[model samples]
Every structure is written in C-alpha cells, then in structure tokens.
Target: MTRPARRIARTAAAGAAVLLALSACSSQGSSAPEASGSSPSSRKLSGTVTVFAAASLKESFTALGRQFERQHPGTRVTFSFGGSDTLAASITAGAPADVFAAASTRTMALVTDREDAAGTPVTFVRNQLEIATLPGNPHKVSSLKDLTRSGLKVVLCDRTVPCGAAAREALDTAGLTLTPASYEQDVKSALTKVELKEADAAVVYRTDVKAAGDKVEGVEFPESATAVNDYPIALLKDAPHTAAAKAFIELVRSPRGLKVLSEAGFLAP
Candidate 1:
C-alpha cells in the first residue's frame, strides 16, 4: 500500500465521523428540546395516572374515573382509596401518585405544607357527620345527644379520620362528649359496624350514610352545621400525569361531578 493511499483513507474516515455526529444532533432536534437541567429527550403524558382519594369518595370517584379514562382514550385513571391521612402519608413517603383528593382540608394541608402539592387545591365538596343506626332505627336514636345514652352500643371513627375530627367538633358544639366502644380507622369501617349490626350507631359521613342504602338510618343533628367538612383536591408536585390530574380535578368541580357527589349526599362546597 502507498503512503498517499493510507493518508486518503484516514481523511475519509474523519469526514464520515463528522457527518454522523451532525446527523445525530439533527435527530435530537426533531423531538421537543429539553429544558435546561432536564434530560435531552422529554416524555409524553400518557399511560396510567394514579389518584389517592379519600375512602368516602370511592363510589363517585370510581364512576368518574371510568368516564375520565373513556374521554382520554389511551390514558387510565387508577385510584387508591383510604383514610385521607393515610393517603397523605403514603404520598409523602414516595408513593407513585398523580393526584390527592382528601375528605378534609386539614388532611390536604399536610401534603401542601410538605410542598408535595403542585398547586393550591380547590374545595370540591362538603361533608358532615351523621348518626348511622341499624335498619328501621330500632333504638329511636335521633341526635348526637341520644348517643350519649349509656345503654346504646356505639362505634365511632378514630380521630385520625376526617369524619372523626368533625364528630368531635360537632359534639363540642353541642356541648356533649362521647365515649365510643371502639374507634374505627375510617367512616366505612365505623359504618360497617352498624351495617353488620355490631354497633347500634356509628358517627360517619353523610355520604356514607346514604351509600349504606337503607342498611343504616342517618340522623342529622343541628350541631353538625358547626362541623362541616370541606373536601379539597389537588395535583401532586411530582405528578406522573399532570394533565390528567388537572382533568380529573376539573371533572370533580363540573356539573356531572357535582351531581355524582350530591346524589351520594355530599353538600356543595
């Protein structure tokens, strides 16, 4: 091989490398340019969106979520329903979630104060505590004052659940205090005790009172007015589906959403 031939081949290789580098940069430019401090290739908002909602929002949210998925086509809305405080703790601990819908403003504050929320939340609904009694109201219990009667077996939500907090406020407003047989973790469980006929009455959310479907009779007391619970919802700071989270939130504040909540006995915020 001649020296000139060897030099010509080396020059050709260098030129080819330059062309490849330019081609790669051009390809990168075709996609959305990454913002400063971000990765070169950004992502699209699609796939699953996880929502951690309060247990009381279960029936209404489950229906709305299906509608949300239908509207978004490829996107899915997955929900984890539980006590709002429990959900908040899970989110703060790095659970993969896109949104948080709480039964109480106090619970929402826990997430927001931690800077876990993306934006200020909006009030979606209001709830008040009610007396959930056995079918047919056998004991003739009518008010928070009635539950204080010694003979009745009563169950109430633990202070951790929003309903319990509201219950305490209602009792305080009425100038009454209650001693329950047990403090259930959530309204559903407390109501379940009534449904199963385990307890004569349980203090649970008004929506839960309705969802019980005649299995329990709801007794609304005047003092519940002072203990109205505001339901707040918001998108998380690290939402995996910000758009969908915003959409779901919009749905909750929409007429359709309000109707679902209202029919379930939630009051307008």
Candidate 2:
C-alpha cells in the first residue's frame, strides 16, 4: 500500500477507537442514574414523618412507626394520638402533620370534607366497643345492659370521639341508656379511669381493653357488632415530608402492618 494511504488508514482507525471509547463512557454515565433511580431502595427517604392517629391506635401504630424508621435509615416517625375528632380539627386548623389515622369514617370525613386530606382515606382496621371493668368479679359486668345498673360508676368517652360514638351506637342499639359519671375526651382517658379504679366500668374499644391487659377486664356484648368503628388513614394535604409520609402510610397498609394491628386486637377492615 502507498505511504499516504497507509497513514490515512492508521489515522482513521485511531479516530474510530477514540469515538468507541467516548461512546462507551457516555453510555455508562447516562445509564448509571437510570439504573439507580429505578431501584426502590435507591430512593432513600429522610426527615420526620409526623402522624396524627386515634388514641386506640397507640400501640399498633407505634410498632409500625418503629418499623418504618428502621426501613428508612434517615427517617423518623413521630405520633400524636388523640380522639379522631380532635385530630381532624387539628388538621383543619393548620396543624403541620404528615399523616392522619382516624378511628372512624365519620371523623375522617371531618378532614376530607375540609380538604385537609391529600387523598381518600383508606380503612385499615375496625374496632368494637366493650365494657372495661375493674379486674376480678367486682362489677361482674356481663352485658351492655349491665352497664346501666343504678349504682355502677360508669365512665364513657364523650359523644364526639369515635370510641364514644361507638359506645353510644351500641347503647342505642340495645334500646338502653345510662348517664356516665364523667365523659372523657378520648378512649385512652376513659380506659384510664377504669384502669385507675376511678370508675367501676367504662365503655371503650376492645383493643384498648386488650392493651390494658390485667388493668381492666373486657366484657364483650352482641350490640358491639352494630357499632363497630372503621379506622381510616390518610396523608395530610400540607405534609412537610411528602416522601417520608408516603412511605410511612405504605408501611401501615402493608402485610407487616396488618400483622401488628391484628395482634393488637384490631379486626381487619
């Protein structure tokens, strides 16, 4: 071959090699982000996820919150447990919260109606009312009607809260009514009354009674079936940590979340 032809061929081969190297480098650079970005684990969540939940969900949601924080290394889960109505009011009053888990659909409506909820609330669990009496056969509270006994010092959640509302429904279904000695703001507060022996019996959730363990004895009634409360959860409209909030809610609706809630005596939704 002629020298000029050979030189031209050598230069062209070198140029091709350089272009191939550049192309390979470009491919690696472009694909790296796409590959990593597509992975679920690669989307790490950070910041605090503040959850406002019903008083009845204290135990199960706390377990789920810990699980969420463990799954997301840089994330933290904070909870504010109270009456569903109070939580709903707080959310509507510009409270900064990532999530809201209410004990009843009616209470959840308070938030959704005000446009404080980011999406439609999903019911995760259902709870029923039970008569929580002091340990032993002190009261022998056998039925919902028994709670209406004249001398029984009964406490009830206020008519506004989910637990209170459920109790009211159950009482109404039984065609009976008894004035409570005191009306508490939340289920925990009403349960606390019995736990502390301040009241002979209190109408509270089965879950709360289970949580109370030996502190209070649970007496189930047939009327509870008609008044079961459906617990719903949702993301708030003005969440500070949107990503973390979504992850937390996903964890709550996952299989593990159901397991924890089931163990807490919460029935499936």
Candidate 3:
C-alpha cells in the first residue's frame, strides 16, 4: 500500500468518529427539553393556594389538596368549606380565594357573572340528595315522605344552599311539603345534626353521609332523581398563586382526584 493511501484512510476514520460524537450529543440535547424547564410539571410550584369549596366537598377536596401539597413540596393548600351560596357571596365581595368549587352551577354563576372567575366553570362531579338518619336508621325513614312525619326533629339545609335547593326539588317531585324543625346554613351542619343524634333526619348529599361514615346512615330516595346537583370548579381571576391554582384545578379533574371523589359517594358528571 502507498503512504498517501494510508494517510487518507486514517483521516477519513477520524472525521467519521467526530461526526458520530457530534450526532450523539445533538440527539440527547433535542430529546430532553424538560431539563431546560420546558415542561410545566417539572417546575416546583411554591406558594399558598386559597380554595373556597362547597361544604359537601370538604373531605374529597381536602384529600386532593394534601396530594397537591405533597407533589409540590413548597406549596400550601388552604380551604374554606361552606355553603355554595355563602362562598359565592364571599367571592363576589372580594374574598381572597385562589380557586372556587361550587356545588351548583347557579352559585358558580354568581362569581362568573361578577367576573371573579378566570374562565368558564367546569363541572367536576354530580351529587344527589339522601336522607341522613341515625346509625342503622333507627327511625326507619325510607323515603322523603317519612321526613315529614309529625314530631320528628328534622333539620334541613337553608333554601339558599345547593343541598337545600336539591331537597326542595326532591320534595316537590314527591309532592311533599316538609316542615323541617330547623334550617341549617350548610349541608355539613344539617348532617352534623343527624350525626350527633340531635335531629331525627336531614336531607343532605350522599357524600355527606359517607363522610360521616358509621355516624349516620344514608337512605336513597327515588325523589332524589329529580334533583341532581352539578359541582363546578374554576380558578379565580388574578389568583395570588396563579400557577398553583391552575395546577390544583387540573389535579381535581384528574383521575387521581376522581378516584378520591368516587369513593366519597359522588357521581361523575
């Protein structure tokens, strides 16, 4: 073999090795944009998210909030659970909430109408009314009509709240006029009455009864079919923790959130 031919062959091999190295570097750089913070999920969200959710969502939302805080180590989730109407009023009055989750669209509208919501509300779950009675249903209350029995210390949600509206619709469907002994401000209050055995029964959401666990028994009534509450959640306008609030909302609509909610006796919308 000639000297020139040998030198040419050696140079060609070196150039090919350099090209392969450059190609490998380029391939790795293009495949992992996440290292450059291109993925939102890759970012660690830091800040507190103030959430105003319906009374019925206290348990499930609390679970999701903790999960969110765990996923974002530096983040904190604060919640104010109450009647949807009361929450709506607070939001409209400029409450410091990053997100709002209402039990009914009507209450959600109060926020959206006032431009307090960042966007159109999304329905996350549906709830049906159930008669929450003493453990084992000692009163033997099987239907809505039973709630109207004389001398039965029954408590009902205020007519302004979502649960109360649903109870009204259910009673209307059954053609029954129930005169509850007291009208509670929220579903939790009404359910609490039954849990403490202070009231014979209360018309509340099935999820409420489930949250109460063995403390109370849930009785499904056919009239509940006429009134199903749709829960809508949305991020608020100009949230202090905009990114965290958005992330929280996404988590609630995610499969993980759905699993927690389903186990609480809430139906998917």
Q: lDDT values of the candidates?
A: 0.87, 0.90, 0.91
Candidate 1 lDDT (Cα, 0 to 1)? 0.87
lDDT of 2 at 71: 89
Which candidate tops lDDT? 3
| Alpha-carbon deviation at 70 in model 3, angstroms | 0.9
lDDT by residue for model 2 (1-269), tens: 99999999999999999999999999989988897666332477899999999999999989888888888898999999998899899899999999999999999999999999898899988988888999994878899899888999999999999888888888898999789999999999999998888999999999999998999888999999999989989989999998789878888888988999999999999
My TM-score estimates for the predictions, one after another, are 0.82, 0.86, 0.86
Q: What are the runs in model 1 whose C-alpha is more than 4 Å off?
A: 1-45
lDDT of candidate model 2 versus the reference: 0.90
Residue 196 error, candidate 3, Å? 1.5
- Model 2 alpha-carbon drift over 4 Å, by segment: 1-42
Candidate 1 per-residue lDDT, tens place, 106-151, comes to: 9999999999999899898998878899999999998889999998
lDDT of 1 at 233: 90
Score candidate 1 by TM-score against the native. Answer: 0.82
- The clash count for each model shown is 0, 0, 0
Q: Report each candidate's C-alpha RMSD, comma-separated, in the order given.
A: 9.9, 4.3, 3.9
Per residue, candidate 3 scores C-alpha lDDT tens digits across 151-269 of 88999999999999989988888899988889999999999888888899999998998888899988999989899999999999968988889889889998999999999999999
Worst 10 residues of 2 by lDDT: 35-44
Rank by lDDT, descending?
Answer: 3, 2, 1
